[model samples]
Target: MLPAAAGYDRGITVFSPDGRLYQVEYAIETVRRGTLALGIKSTDGVILAVEEKTRKLQISNVTQKIFQIDDHIGLAAAGYIPDARTQVDHARFFAQSNRLIYDEVVDVEGVAKNLADMAQQYTQYAGARPFGVALILAGVDKNGIGLYLTDPSGTYIGYDAVAIGAGSEQVTEHLEKNYRNDISLDKACVLAIESIFMVSEEKTGTKHIRLAVIDSKSKTLRMMPLEEIENYSKQVQDKESQS
Candidate 1:
């Protein structure tokens, strides 16, 4: 049956409408992945943010493996870096492989759903473990400006805005109070940066951060400039000092 047997006892074949055989998954690979907590919303169709965290003094990069695979779509991660990288890589590969199917553009929402599917498929093929990953994919998909949150177990959701990483719980709390259906890109961006700062502040050993976003309509990713971060940091400091 499953994973127990080495070679296939018989050649597996499937027939299409014209008697065609489709082959998939001869054998499975070991090594499981991890999970991430992702959040998202789609209030405004202007901009969305992806906040990444590793270590304040991290020797190795947390975002080392993940890159902007396409325009208008950025990834933010938390928990099980390697596993998250694998799943994101897999999603990128899958989308690229079928680029033509999407007219040289992969729908961010579609990509996100595919990512969720990945988690389930992985679980079926490999036994579950600590290796789990959560992803927040933000950008305009085939539909419109949107956001998506995916889990290690292969579950995906479309949203208007999103967040992912260590401070998800605290960040979510920040969103509920700030997010609204009519929020604009500028407002959403501020909320994201602010939420991240709020979350990261809770953790003692975090400093430098990576932030990126996919503007509405276009598929290009723009990383938030360091100066922008400095401004936000200043604001954070001022608000904290006020409190």
Candidate 2:
């Protein structure tokens, strides 16, 4: 026999009898299956990190999931990468448009809201499928540091520290237990590495990791080099030894 949800699952615009949108839920599920990605907002700045598995022969220098949306805004993604690229392009255009029109950089929350609205529209339209991804958006702006998560449901919420994708429940719990509002930017980098090591397959190396920082001092986005990431990993290891 066919299930009750069988018919509704076929259309993005259709809702199941229980008022649930199966297509949207399925899109979110795609995010759950992706690798780990997280963001941390420290007193001095924001950190964006992601774990990306690479082929043994593939180039490892280029990051596949983290993106710089503007001078002060960056994001880490989990789920269908093509979808992430699409959303990022949209965000870049929006950010630039805001700059041209307002003569000011777009705030982090504004970009989050814009992407969430775009994600939501796909749910109401018949021929479109929801974006199969979720993003951790973090940056520094006039209001100080901002961190937010945007999901396939078109919902956006702010957070001090947050993780998404596989094993995020465990990772999020770790962040909640250890996160502090006054945490320093350097410590936050180590903490991000520790959180990823808790679940990532590449436990001992910096090759699979990608990091970007938007600091209050600079108010600009910059990718961390492998050498710097290695230094933070050493700190993580030293702390583990002490405990």
Candidate 3:
């Protein structure tokens, strides 16, 4: 009842009448997974930030895996963290497979497009309302610093910068005003956390936030801490006072 190649990436070698079992990893051993956010900068440098608490810290256990498929690309997002990880897992496998054939990091865009394709598939599995996930994918591809926000329903939005999750509205508003054609990584880092807070404050129910940046120079991903983000939040107040 299943194609011979169906679910090939997950190590399914045989065609079973029923679907195969998928093993979920424990969070504590992982890097940074769960309800989070991300930011990418393409200025003189690159930086990425993420909240340590993970999903408002309400859950007793959460993973801190910063889903980075390649050294050049990074991902931060929200909703169904495990599903997001699966998307990343697929991308990682593709990147590895491509490297074996072409011997490079593999095309970042191609990898992203493949991910978009999977997002739609993930949505279809849900009977109603659709099982969902959203992503702020950032990295340095062949053309250079690329940014995109992709949804679980197989739709994606390309951007120089983007935000996802509980504070997306607030973050989007901040981007409209402060996001210029180019800016320093330092400035972008501070702005990133503030946007998440802007929404967190309004909802009065948000806690964790994660951010990432893709450096145009070295093509690296940097994740920041909550304390560092809090410091930047205070600076915003100081700057506001001067203004």
| RMSD (CA, Å), each prediction | 8.9, 1.1, 9.4
**How do all the candidates rank in terms of TM-score, highest first?**
2, 3, 1
* Residue 87 of model 3, lDDT score: 78
The clash numbers for all candidates, in the given order, read 25, 0, 18
Query: For model 1, what is the C-alpha lDDT against the true structure?
Result: 0.55
Cα lDDT tens digits for candidate 3, 1-243: 237435532432222345432211111112122334655555654445544453353662333536787888777756666666777888889888888899877666677688888755543342322325666677786776677766644666677666555555566777888887677777887676666556553322223555555667777765554566567667766666698
Could you say which candidate leads in TM-score? Answer: 2
Cα lDDT, all candidates:
0.55, 0.94, 0.59
Q: Clashing residue pairs, candidate 2?
A: none
Cα deviation of 10, candidate 2, in Å: 0.6
TM-score of each: 0.68, 0.98, 0.70
Angstrom error of the Cα, residue 239, model 3: value is: 1.9
Off by over 4 Å in 3: 1-36, 45-65, 123-131, 202-209, 225-231
* Span of ten consecutive residues with least summed lDDT in model 1: 27-36
* Pairwise TM-score winner, candidates 1 and 3: 3
lDDT score for residue 153 of model 3: 49
In candidate 2, position 187 carries an lDDT of: 94
- Model 2, CA-based lDDT: 0.94
Deviating ranges (above 4 Å) for candidate 2: none
- Of the two candidates 2 and 3, the one with more favorable TM-score, higher being better, is 2
